[model samples]
Target: MFSGLITYLDSIRARDPAPRSRWEVLFYPGVWAVGLHRVAHWLFQARLYFLARFVNHFSRFLTAIDIHPGATIGRNFFIDHGFTVIGETAEIGDNVTIYQCVTLGGTNPTNGVGGKRHPTLEDNVIIGSGAQIIGPITIGQRGRVGANAVVTDDVPEGATMVGLKARSTLVPAEEWIKDFIPYGTPCDEPCEELMETGAGRLAELESQLAEMKAELAAIKAERAQPIKRNGTDD
Candidate 1:
């Protein structure tokens, strides 16, 4: 693959170049790699199956990136060129930017006779390049997955996930997110809060009423008792 040679060249350049201008002419292997990927996909779509397949294999060998031709990708699917891998079953949303070294793969390696082996990204989800989303979980609309996070389960709508197992750390719309289970601040639901407060107040008032009735009964009992004797003859 051309990418492999480029990587080796880049590495050698890094080591052998003069210290003053070592990185002056940095070569980006990823840009051409991604651009080539798009072209290969285009070839396949245009019915040049054999050439497309060859390009795909070669690209992977060189760039360490393997994008499945069958994967449904929307508009503006840009990935920073590098060791990136996208699975055959991966479904990418529109305007999604994937950085280098990201993996959208399956747990069992073959997509495992899939019913839904890869993650389904919704619209406007910004995955900080290097995020790995595996399994058939649904990442809700506008969710953000932080860099290098390993996601295995479903993420709630408009939430931000970081760390391993991808726990929802923040919800952009607090009230709309109730599935935040990991260090998530309670969503602000004014109506729900008001209902709870009202219910609590009602219980307190009922207790106060019961206590007042008991006091009134005690006073009446005292008045009806021995006080009658004081109202006697003299």
Candidate 2:
């Protein structure tokens, strides 16, 4: 666990998350999560709901991640980076990898009815950052969701979903697949001025097109006008 911290600190150039150096009590995030979640799960099982939530909140605050008490996360569930949030009623299968900004959320808010609203993740499911999975859906085993994808329905096992309202893409066995699709992790600067210039030009052309259309309409009206009163052609 201490080594996990070392690796994590090395991974990011930001400030350290912990000051503890004791090897005995120290644990890696994977180990810590597995261990702590077991305890939290027990607390939840024992109906210590409030206390479990409190501990879950603390874990998330300290780790920059959050998992709700009502969530049933299986063994070896892993999360990387910050801004990951799991809903209370979410059920995660074993070996799920959740990246940053991923949300396993509830679809329609509960209006006091006691039914399942959160999505269920099957084993080995991997979710990329900024992905939203809503509704009482089942993401089948080994299913992968791409970055920024918004899912509201069921996904079959081993299927990959992408785009805004994510649709599944069937993958062949030969393809090299990754748990999380790489997106939005860029630190390099982009050509903003060039993009802005192109946008500006497009806007200018649209404005010119509108003006030309107006002028053409005025000319047509002028030509369409019959000769005034007595001046009208017989």
Candidate 3:
């Protein structure tokens, strides 16, 4: 058990550069939150719902992280900072890292029945700060969601998602091969490439618009021409 704790702390250290030592990691709110969540989850599984809820509330009071007792979390699930909420039906896989102020939110069932309402994070998935992963969408393995993204769809494996409505950004092989990317975004090259692509698309659209205008003008000119009767001008 001690060795497993050490491994978990080391995993957090590997991801965060601010921690000077494992001892410092122990003092992190995220660490406390995960620890307390374990107790709450055990109680929840044992059918002690009240006790589980009490523990969960206490953990939230102490760590400012709200993880539902019913949520299933796998090994090395790290919440980097506080103000994160995990819904009841949320399922998180191993090595899933979530930054501050993220939500694994649920949607109301139309049939009024409880089911898988929250998002699922596959192994090695990273969710940046303030990201809202709504509904029962699954973020695939190695998927990276950028800060402030609002995702409502399933993310493909190894994809990088960004923007308000959260669209996947095309990442180069070299960039995608990295083991970890902070804030789940490769801003330098990928952003520039997107800009260039957008510009090219805009130019292509403008060219097509010009061609369409020319065709319309030709049609109008042909229609406006005087009609001829028996080869005579009318």
All models: lDDT? Answer: 0.64, 0.68, 0.93
Per-residue alpha-carbon lDDT of model 3 for 144-204, expressed as tens digits? Answer: 9999999999999999998889998878888888889888877675454555456666687
Count: clashes, candidate 1:
2
Best by TM-score: 3
User: Which runs in model 1 stand beyond 4 Å of their true positions?
Assistant: 1-34, 42-50, 109-112, 172-234
* Residue 39 of model 2, lDDT score: 67
Query: lDDT tens digits, residues 24-129, model 1?
Result: 3234454445556677778878888788778888878877778766566764454545678877667878645566688888777564566667888876566666
Model 3 compared with the native: what TM-score?
Answer: 0.84
Best of the candidates, lDDT: 3
* Model 1 C-alpha lDDT versus the unseen true structure: 0.64
Which portions of model 2 miss their true places by more than 4 Å?
Answer: 1-34, 109-111, 176-234
- For model 1 the TM-score comes to 0.54
